[model samples]
Target: MAGSFHGLTVFNNNVHAQNSDSLSQADIAEPLFDIEKETYIGTILQNAANPTFRFDPRKGKSPSAFFAEVDPTPSAPGINEMVKPPTFPNVSPVAPDGLIVSSPGFHFNEQNNAMSAFQNALVPPKPNITISNSETDDGYNVFSKAGCIKCHAGSYFTNHQIIPADKIGTEPSRAKALAKTAKIFAEPLLYSPTENVPIRKNARVLKIPLNNIDEQQLRLGFAHDGKGGYKTPSLIGLYWQAPYLHDGGVAVGYEHNYGLTGTLLKGKPVDPYRSIIALVDRKERQKVIKANASLHSVHITGDGHSFWVDQESGFTKKEQIALAKYLLSLNKGRTEQQ
Candidate 1:
């Protein structure tokens, strides 16, 4: 519940290139797991008055092409609250103002667009979420009976809505981490192509739509004033990734409890099959949480989402295992089944 703490709230970017690098975190298999998405690109692209970038891409050295406003002050004042495992290349030489490309018309956008298109083309269409026979008889019935299907509905297993921190309470730090960014967005000196002198008259700025966004949800999603929320991600690829939740605090190794450190280490793989059981079985989850605690992992716990598949929830251990197996077996829903 640290007010100024940010744990798993990272600006989502393509990790493909990062994974190949020797310096990257070993757990490259789990991609797109960060809480936030493309902070810099998300900010300047929108015409929102107070466009802010949280992490100063340019700090001790020259700024990156992506550098915007630099917030020199540390996020948290106390040394005890300082961010751990800091982002790389802390220093860089400052680049020219025009080099901070924020406009859609910037030359880099074409390459970005092309790369995006290529990536999209490379992604195969989502497979149908076909329930196996065993899953239909055992897991799906219990999952539905437990009312899990309400939020985790749809073929992808997500309703794609940002649930309020207060409502679906998990870790609050990451949800509230971006509250300061909203202030940055409101800064009149915010960096963007429009801020550049002799602004390009023909620049094609993207006017991001906010039509359907709920006001409360929007504010909550940013953790503005400590009331932000989190998006329910798709459960489609649960097999390939483990250590559930935004902070990845919930993790269990193949035959033992690896804790949160298991999340960072690619060598210690999280047994997705068992982890799902840990997720819904309260007793197993307690063991996982205790393991995560032993690692001194911050802002993460397998505590919330306590709709258990345990005896307390009138479910036997065998039923819980079956439900976990069913959950693990899920894939993208078949169109014909829909």
Candidate 2:
């Protein structure tokens, strides 16, 4: 249940960390006390002479803390800036048993700083050629009237809230698959960002704030609502993001093909307008649904989010077209509206 940088990590830790069977390739060259590792430093070198003196990082640590432990060089331009291989940084020369620090507070800040910088440097998408103020306004009206603003609200367009499995009505198994995430859920904690390279004693521990988020909503986002759910995403780049729904199930091709079987799997490019039309029109959705029937067992059926603007729903054909065009007109420099 996080929002900023920390929020994303929390989200990853929940649904991914528990069931991930993957091993670390990078953690091999360097090592730490992480749970599932082939080449952890703590494993490679241990004293066999006395069992008391040897330590596996896991013995004293909680599984909830960090995942992988990496030490990327903090500085640029050459040999001097390279990170020394992670050895027992806290091991004392004379202590009876050398210390083994948990993987959590070790060597993470510099790497996170690098990641933050890369993200900050990214540019927002520019307005597309087809976008126009009048058309965008028309689309906005249809969008609001159609009740999309309910969950896809706010300046960023996502309430960041989970739409329940029953409500989204797409695939429930994918969301329910994450139910085990709650077992590992813990408060997001870290050594303060300002700390030095070798984190010293008395390093400030920070608890990432999960403000404005409902605890149930947060848990369900990871839990997938007991049965599962979909988190509302920002509608910012709808300009060309096709195969519209979460499962990438709602697909409509450039030459009027439909579904994953007919489109993406067959090298047919998706058309943004037609895909959006299929997204809102129940009649077109049936075509997509039937086209994807082969994959329904694997849950790629283009189902759910039953909101519609088709003639059956009383909206005119012209209004439906306007809505599709308007969604694509986003980022043509129109300000974000709720």
Candidate 3:
């Protein structure tokens, strides 16, 4: 105490105050990226085999044109549907050895179709990861482990397969969801059973088989047969694709359910942070709550089930954030490292 520090105290205090202000500003301000710096870093980190493809959104050019040019052709009725697969236009057939054609069998009449199919086939198989390491490489591992990949695999982020929970033997889970909705609906004094409830009408049509494990069997009755079930949605670029779920019930990244607005139900918000804007108005809040309740009911009933993180699965908030980050990166065309 008797001996003073070597450095000047006044000078040190002034420097510290300046540094504190700098730190405070940094904390409050949004981070900005240097495009040139990012590009340089990206170039260095780019994978030779799976190079990240960047396209200018403002230019409004066709994304497909970047890869190759192909004229649209009518489909053969018996062979395939005219609707393009999610994999179309993104995946190409160029062989690793630089060979254009990978297949030997090509018909003169079906040359275009064959080449298209071959290109699709040539697209590299999706990379697989186990749970422990799945979250390692930019957290895409969590997506694969969570069974999200089962439905959302490929360039377009979908397998284009309509998977039914009943077929997957999750009818009991669906029943639980429906029961929850019914209970919520019963509690709302404003929600009259007689009040032209479109959702109630929609829910009545769901016919889950007592014993069905095969999706094909389930799909015969449940796949949009007026029961309102469809293929699992691709989560590709899901960041830009907001208002999550098939019915667009909940806005992406927010807890507020789109259908739950204006319904009397008491529960924690689905996405409280993102839903603040809607919740500002009492009427709007009611509408969002009602919409969410409807969606929550559907989710529980297994009509349109998306995975969630819970203690049983060891998917914590941290993991969910990591998974969300990985998904957002895909939307931006950024690789796992980014």
Candidate 4:
């Protein structure tokens, strides 16, 4: 959408925006919005609120400010950055709300409540006849003892940190997607007119904070020039979400046809339980990777984070199953107690 808007403005017409329909030929095989079960929309907003990109000052302003800048005519890059067409309409620019704002789709306040009450609502299901307490314990033990806790920490099961594509060894395409973002407009133009009079006045700019960041980590986490880092995700209700990883390639659901993509208009259904097993077991993960690579985009590989829990890792088959059961048992709030 940002691409469409930028093409429209920079080219001084709606030709590129109209041409987008011609560009989208493939069927939508993207992951469902019923995501990792911890309010990812909120996480994105928080990331945007941060000043620097991936903790690097060289990255210029954060995504929130960059997209919010409604000034179509930017001077720093020079008005002659592109050839202005004769049909260019002299109209007030629309704020890039669709890029950052949620439409009237989901009810939760994605900008403010991702890590709070909205996240709390994404709990796991209750224990069933097949699941036992001992299984959950074994799973938790395997997760902790295997050193997974170092990164996937806290009640949300994530440290809320961004790691470089190299360190985690995932598909790097999406990480590098925004590497060359231009600072088209300054921060003063970001405030929407909807804000209160005192706060909504034009030309009001607050300097975003740029201190107290882990520079070394930032260096490792993104390009030295400041781009491309994947945020560690929270593992809240692992049972409900299918097609794990930043890319939704590590998916399952087609067999029983019950998972996220099962809705009539969406892609084929997958089994969340089976897909997760594939996530933990390296051999199984390879099969998923192969499948994802065959049909999905380059960014949608199920590879990386090869921390396995199978026999090769010296775990017995029973223990592996136990760990899977324990993972499936994860839930929050009253549902956990039940």
lDDT of every predicted structure (CA atoms)? 0.50, 0.59, 0.34, 0.47
lDDT of 4 by residue, 1-338 (tens): 11122112312222222222211101111122233322332234335433431222244754334423532323111111121111111111221111112112322122322333343444466634267666667877888877778888876678867777777777777676433321221121222313332232243333322244465544433343455678777676777666677766676664633223332226666666777777778877776766555445445667787778888988877777777776666666223344
All candidates: CA RMSD (Å) = 13.0, 10.6, 27.9, 15.0
Ranking by TM-score: 2, 1, 4, 3
TM-score for candidate 2, please give it.
0.68
Report the lDDT tens digits of candidate 2 across residue range 56-123: 56666422122222212222111112121122121111100111112233453444344445665554
Residues 1-338 of candidate 3 have per-residue lDDT tens digits of: 00012112212222332232221111112222123433432332233232334433355544333222221222210111121111211111110000111112322113333334454344232322122334446467667777767777766677655455444333233222212111111110111212221222222221212232343533332232322234555554444443443434444134434443422234433442333223222344345445555446545211234245443457665665556556644532224324
Regions of model 1 farther than 4 Å from truth: 1-108, 111-132, 186-206, 261-266, 334-338
Which digits, one per residue and each the tens of the lDDT, describe model 1 over residues 1-338? 10001111111111222222211211211122232334423333244343443334334432222233432222211111111111111200111010111223333222323444554344234332355686557877888888888888876678878787767757777677555434223211112323332234443333333445566665666665566788876666566667787667778887675566555555677777777887887778888777677544567676677677789989887788777777766554534334
Who wins the lDDT comparison?
Answer: 2
Best by TM-score: 2
What's model 4's lDDT at 151? 87
From the highest lDDT down, the ranking of the candidates is: 2, 1, 4, 3
TM-score of 1: 0.61
lDDT of 2 at 192: 59
TM-score, each model? 0.61, 0.68, 0.33, 0.56
Which pairs of residues collide in model 2? 2-7, 127-332, 224-228
